[model samples]
Target: MKRNIAVVWGGYSSEIVVSAKSMAGICSFLDEEKYNIYKIRITKEKWTVEVGGYVYTVDKNDFSYICPISDQRIYFDFAYIIIHGTPGEDGRLQGYFDMLGIPYSTCGMMASALTMNKFICNNFLKNFGIRVADSLYLNKDTKYNLRGIEEKLKFPLFVKPNTGGSSFATTKVKAVDQLQQAIDAAFGETPDVIIESFISGREVTCGCYKTKDKEVVFPITEVVTPNEFFDYEAKYEGQVEEITPARISGEMTDEIQRLTRKVYDLVGAKGLIRVDFIISDNQPFLLEVNTVPGMTQTSFIPQQIAAAGLDIKEVLTEIIENEFNAI
Candidate 1:
């Protein structure tokens, strides 16, 4: 019997467009013969499932959809989560799926929550002796010591939303004068933000995933952006050149892969994830882990996957099989 697979996309986050694109790519590659796929679009306004040019409202009680024409109810056997932020990336959706006993792609609840918070995740990695940028955390209501931040971190720092990704509301301040405005912008995105001392180095990222049979790491990619940093435009637009097999040495690649696997295990990450890093003074500093990495043609994960001599069909199959076996 063919299993029903729901590719859940869209969330109450700025990355909804990216999530929608990710699901579109994923849906195309999943072997249609083996599984019946449906695109479940979720938003703050509504969660609906489209089938045969008709849309049906999702029954949140059981995550099922009833066809209006036939009045038939359909339930998914598995869920492929692609929502990039909030509710999805932050573990709320995972928790809901857990209660419904539906296996979804990506990490479990606790792991998702831990990794969504930048300050907490970076500090957590420090326990394993992983190098990360020095940062300060600020709440929306607190009085931040701007002078202290300037004194300790110096100029050329970053202000970013504490829990958001895609560099949404992220600002790079090269001088003290730009600090306040950046903070306000970051706070506008989220109530909490992290201010970090800039780590000057080559920006590279490694994609990895662990399955029941084995663990796999894709080739590292070097990010060279024409902008000030790998911000929103650089990531989604033509403002960046992402070089795969990252013009680095064998030693560097091995080290990065080792760290990648180690962090994957440390965070108990499942499915595919991309870990960003900055190599300075010949030492790699952990930037962030994307549990739900992008799947678009221009995204880094797809580039890394292709560079590894593997296609998305095989890669996603392995991940889905692993999740199926676990359930």
Candidate 2:
């Protein structure tokens, strides 16, 4: 019997565009003969499934819907969450799935919540001896002291929404005069903003996932962008060069892979996750952990999987089956 799988995508954030691309990539990679795939589109307006030019509404009560053609109630056995932002990325959707006793393809509620907020996640990891850049966290209600901020962190700081992704409303401030404007821009995305001192070095990212039987860590990818940083344009607009099996020493690559595994275990993460880092003076500094990393054909995870000489369909099968095996 084929299990019904709901590939959930879209969110209430700007990353929804990226999510659409990931949705396409995931649907293409999934094994059609083994499982029944349903494309669930989530938006601020509705949760629906469109099939053969017909649309059916999802029953949020059970995460299901009535098949338009067969007039039969279809319930999803598993949910492949590809939504890049809340309520999918921030644990809200995880809580809903938990209530329905449905398995998903991302981190659980606690890990998702912790990682969505970059400020808290990085600080929490810092206590575990993960090297991170100095940063300050601020909320909309908090009174920020510009002079104190400048005194603590040097120039060329990065200002970004503490709770979102896809580099939306993220800015690089090279001077104290540009700091306020950057923070304001970030605030437009979320109520909380994070200001971190820049790390001048090579930017690299690694992807990993572990099952009960084995751990799989992918090849590291070096990101070289002529832009100020790896912003939205560089990530999705083909403005960046991504080199897999990064041009680094063998020892450094091994250490990075080791740290990637450690971080995955630390956060109790499930499914595919990516960790970004910056190497400065031969030391790797943790940037942020992506629990619901992008799965687009051009995204980092797929690229890393290819470099590892692994099949995407096999990887997806392993992830989906791992959840069932655990139960």
- Best model per lDDT: 2
**TM-score, structure 2 vs. true:** 0.98
What does candidate 2's lDDT look like per residue over 1-327, in tens digits?
Answer: 999999999899888999999999999999999999999999989999977777889988989898766889989999999999898989999999999999999999999999999999999899999999999999989898887888888887899999989999999988888889888989999889999999999999999998879999999999999999999999999999999989999999998999999999888899999999999999999999999899888889999999999999999999999999987
Per-candidate TM-scores read 0.98, 0.98
What C-alpha lDDT, on a 0 to 100 scale, does residue 79 get in candidate 1? 91
Residues 1-327, candidate 1: write the lDDT tens digits: 999999999998788988988888899878888899999999989999999887889999999988877788989999999999898888999999999999998899999999999999999999999999999999967787778899988889999999999999999998878899999998888889999999999999999988887888999999998799999899887899999989988999999999999999999898999999999999999999898888887788888889989988888888888888987
Candidate 1's TM-score: 0.98
Which residue ranges in model 2 land beyond 4 Å of their true spot? none
Return the clash pairs for model 1, or none: none
Q: What C-alpha lDDT, on a 0 to 100 scale, does residue 208 get in candidate 2?
A: 99
Candidate-wise lDDT, in order:
0.91, 0.93
